[model samples]
Target: MDRSNAFVLVGAVGAGKSSLFNVLFDKEEAALKTQAVVFETGGMDTPGEFFSHPRLYNALIQTVSDVGTIVYVHDGTDRTCRLPPGMLRVYGGKRVVGAITKIDMPECDPDFAERLLRENGVNDAIFRVSSRVRETVGPLKRFLFGELSDGPHACGDVERKKA
Candidate 1:
C-alpha cells in the first residue's frame, strides 16, 4: 500500500475530524479549530464550513481532488445528516468511507449516525470511533492504510467491512 497519498477528512463542524486527524498521524499536540484546509502528513484536515455550506462545496471539492481517500466524519451525537444529495458522488475517482466520530460521548448514538451515513450515500466501510480512545482508532487506521491482512490496502476496491 502506498502511504504517500494523503486521505482527506471531511465532515460537519465539531465532528472531531481534526482530532481524528491527529490520532491518525500520531500527533501529540492538541487539535485546534480548523479554519481552512490544513495539510499534514498522511492526511488532510478540512474545516466544517466546507462541508456544511453549499457555497464552500467547491473548496471541499478542490481540497479532496488530490487525495486518494475521502473519510466522511460525522458526529455521533448529531442526528441530522448534512450531506447534500450526490455530493460525495462527485468524488468518483476517490475511495469514500464514513467515520462516526465521538462515539465515546454518553449522548452519542453511533447506530443512528451509521444509518444516516448509509442513507446519505456512504456505501463504503463505516467505522464507529472515538479519537481519544486508542483501541477505537486502530481498526480505522488499518482500514485506511490497508494494514488488514485480509486485503492489500483500502485504496483498492477491497471488501467493505463495518467497524
Candidate 2:
C-alpha cells in the first residue's frame, strides 16, 4: 500500500477523529505540534482537516477520489445517527469504511452503531474503536489499508460481508 494515500476522517464533534489522525500519522503526542508537517509515501499531499460545512463536501470528494482510502469516524455515543447531508452525498455508495469512535465511554453502544450505519445508508465494514485506549484502531487501519486501499470501487463486497 502506498504511504502517501489520502485517508479522510469523518465524524461528529469530539468524536476523537483528531486522536485517530495522530495515531495514523505516528504522532500520538504530536497533536501538540501545531506546525508539524505530515509525510506520505505515495507523494500525495498530507491529509486534510475534517470539515462540517456542506460547501466543502465537493472539494473533499475530489480530494478523496485522488487519494487511496477514507476512514469515516462515527460517534458511538451519539444516538441520533444523523449524518451531515454533505457527507452522505459525498461518501454515499462509496467503499468508505466506518469506524465507531469513543468506545471507551460508558454510554457507547455497539448495537446502535450498526443501526446508525444502516439508517445513514452506510453499508460497509464497521469497526468499534476507542482512540483513547488505542483499541480497534489497528483493525480499522488494516481495513483502510487493505481492501479499501483502492480508489473508487464497488461497496457491494463490503455490504455483503456485513449482511
Give Cα-based local distance difference scores for all models: 0.79, 0.56
Q: Which is the leading candidate under lDDT?
A: 1
Q: Which stretches of candidate 2 lie over 4 Å from their true place?
A: 1-5, 30-51, 86-93, 147-163
For candidate 1, the TM-score is 0.85
Candidate 2: C-alpha RMSD after superposition? 7.8
Q: Tens digits of per-residue lDDT for model 2 on 1-163?
A: 4333555565555566667777655564734321222334422221234345557556556655644455566777777654655464554434556777767667777677767776776666677776665545666666655544534331211111111
How many clashes in each structure?
0, 3
Clashes of 1: 0
| Candidate whose TM-score is highest | 1
Error of 1 at 30 (Å): 1.6
Looking at candidate 2, the ten consecutive residues that score lowest on lDDT are: 154-163
Cα RMSDs, all models = 6.2, 7.8
